[model samples]
Target: MKIFTPIIINGLAVKNRTVMAPMCMYSAQEDGFVSQFHRVHYPTRAYGGIGLIIQEATAIEPRGRITDHDLGIWSDEHGLGLKELVSMVHMAGGKMAIQLAHAGRKSRNTFEPIVSSCNQRFNDKYDIPKQLSISEIKDIVAAFKQGAKRAKEAGYDGIEIHGAHGYLINQFLSPFTNKRDDEYGGSLEKRTRFLLEILTAVREVWRGPLWVRLSADEYIEQGHRLEDTLKVIDLIKHLIDAVNVSSGGISPSVPKVFPGYQLAFSAAIREKGLLTFGGGLINSIEEAEQALAKEKADLIYFGRPLLLRPFIVLEAAKTYAPELVIPQYERG
Candidate 1:
C-alpha cells in the first residue's frame, strides 16, 4: 500500500503516489489555444483528490503538434487559457505539470501518419514529413524553452519534457527513426543531445521542478534498447529532477499486456539509482501497491484507469491499501 503515501518528485510533495498521466483528448482550437472543454476537464480531476496531474501532450510548435487539435504553448498568446486553468487547479489543491512535445515525422492529422527520418509508408494516409534541417532542429529546442516559460507564466507548478512515444524528441533519441547524419544523429551521444538541450533550455525559463518522460522501450524493429535508453538517462541525470518511464514507439508494435506490465522497466531505471515513475497499462490497488512495494517504480502514473475511476486514489487508500493511507482519510 505504499501507493497511498505522499512522496516528493522533483522536490514537489504530491499528496499521493498517483499521477494523472498525460492523455491527449485533442480538445484544442486550431491556434493551439485551450478551450472550455479543457478547463472543465482538467481541474475536475484535482477535485477528485488525484495527487499530481500531468497535462496532455502539448506541442512546442505548430507542425510539432500531433493532431490539429493538440494543445500548444509555442506562443505567448497560448498562455491566456492555460493561466486560468492553472489557477483553477491550484484553488482545488492539486499540483500540475505540462508535458511539452513535438510530433516530428508524425505531424498532421490526416488518415496517414508521417514518420520522422525515413520516407517509410505510414499506417495511415498523410503527407510525407519534410526532414528537419539543422536550423529547424535548433528552432524546435527554442520552442520547448518558450513553452516552459509560458507554463511558468501561466502558473503551472512544473514542466515535463515529453521524450517518448515516437515524438520528435524520442525520434531524435532513437537511431531507428533519426537517420540524420549531422551532429543531431549517429551515435547515442548525438541522439541524446536533443533531449539534453531541451532540458537545459527549459531550465533557464522554468524555475519550478522539471521532469523528463521517456518511452521505456519502442516495440519497433531496430528500435531503441533498454541499455541505450539508460545511456540517455545517464547523460541527462544532472539536468532534470526525475525520469518518468513508459514504453513503446521505439518499435512499431508493442508486446502483449498484463497488469503492471511496465513496472519492470521503471524498476530497472530506478535501480540505476535514479528517481523514476512507471506507466502503461497499470491498474488495480494491488498492482499499484506491488509497484511501490517491490521498488518497481517510485510513483505510479494512471492514464486510462483514472478516467474510468477518478477517485481511485482514495479508494485504494481506504479499501484495499490501508497500510499506505493516513489514519484520518481512513476514519469514518
Candidate 2:
C-alpha cells in the first residue's frame, strides 16, 4: 500500500514509489542503437506496473561506453528509438527516466582511447587510461549537456545522472582514482568540481525531475567512504532532486551483500536533509514497504528482482492497489 501512493518530485508526478532500477541489459547494437530487445524490455515493466522505469546507463559519447553494447545518446539519431521507447512506456501507464553515463577508464570500447581524471587503470585487465586534459574534460562536460537535450527531445519524464559504480563522475569524485592536482581535483571541494560542472550543464536543458546515483561506500580501506559521499552530496544536493544510493562499486571484487544492505547508506545520507533512493538485495515487497514506511528511503528500487520477475509490480499491485492491475488495458 505504501509503495502504491503517488508522489511528486520536482513537479513531476510518479504513479508510485516502486522504481525499476536501471540495470544494463547490454543489448544494444555495436552502433548503440536501441535494439528490438529494448523496445520490448522496458515497456514490459511499465505494463507490469512499474512506477518509474530508469533506463540503464546510456552513454554520452561513443568512447564513454562501458561496453560497445551500451545504448547511446551521443548523436541525434539515437533519439528516434528512445522517443519510441518513451511512447511505449507512456502507453503502458508508467513514467520513465534515463541515466546519462560515461565509463572513463572503465570503457571497453577499445577503438578510442580510454580516459580518466588520472592516468590509471581500474585493474590490469583494463587499459591504463590516458589522463584527461583540461580541454578533454570540458568536451565531456559539454557532451552531458547535449545528452540532456537529447533525453528531453526523446520525452523522458526525468533524468538520473549516473555518478555511481566507478563510472566517469565517480572516478573524478574519488581520491583513489583522481590524482589530479588541477582545479578538478585535490581538496574535497575541488574533487567535486567535475560533477558540479556536469550538473550545471545538464540543468541548462533538463527542467524535469533530476536524480543522481551515488556509490555511497567505495569498499576499500583508503577509497571513499559514506562520509566522503555525504560531503559530495552537500555540494550538489541543491543541484539535483534525489540521490539514488548504492555501495561497494569502486572495487572490482563484489563486497558482502545482504537484505537491506544499502539502506543504512541511504539513511545516513537522508539525515543530511536530502531525499534518497535505497535498496540492495531487498527480496520482498514487504521489506520494500517497510523501508518506505520507516522513511529510510523515499524510493524503493528493485534491480535483480525485477529482472527475475518483470511482472512483480503487477502481482504486488493486485493486493496492494488493485486499481492499477489493468493488464488488458489498451497499450500500444
Q: Among these predicted structures, which one has the highest lDDT?
A: 2
TM-score of 1: 0.91
Root-mean-square deviation of Cα positions for candidate 2 versus the true structure, in angstroms: 1.9
Each candidate structure's TM-score, on Cα atoms with residue i matched to residue i, is: 0.91, 0.97
lDDT of 2 by residue, 1-332 (tens): 78888888898898988899999899998878999999999999998888889999999999899888999999999999999999999998899999999999899996688999998899988998999999999999999999999999999999999999998899999888888989999998998999999999999998889978999999988778999999999999888989999876666968888899899999999898777889998777889999988889988999999887988877877777778889484241
Worst 10 contiguous positions by lDDT, candidate 2: 323-332
Write the residue-wise lDDT of candidate 1 on 75-107 in tens digits. Answer: 889999989988888776688889988887767
lDDT of 2 at 291: 93
Clashing pairs in 2: none
Query: Which candidate should be chosen as best, given TM-score against the real structure?
Result: 2
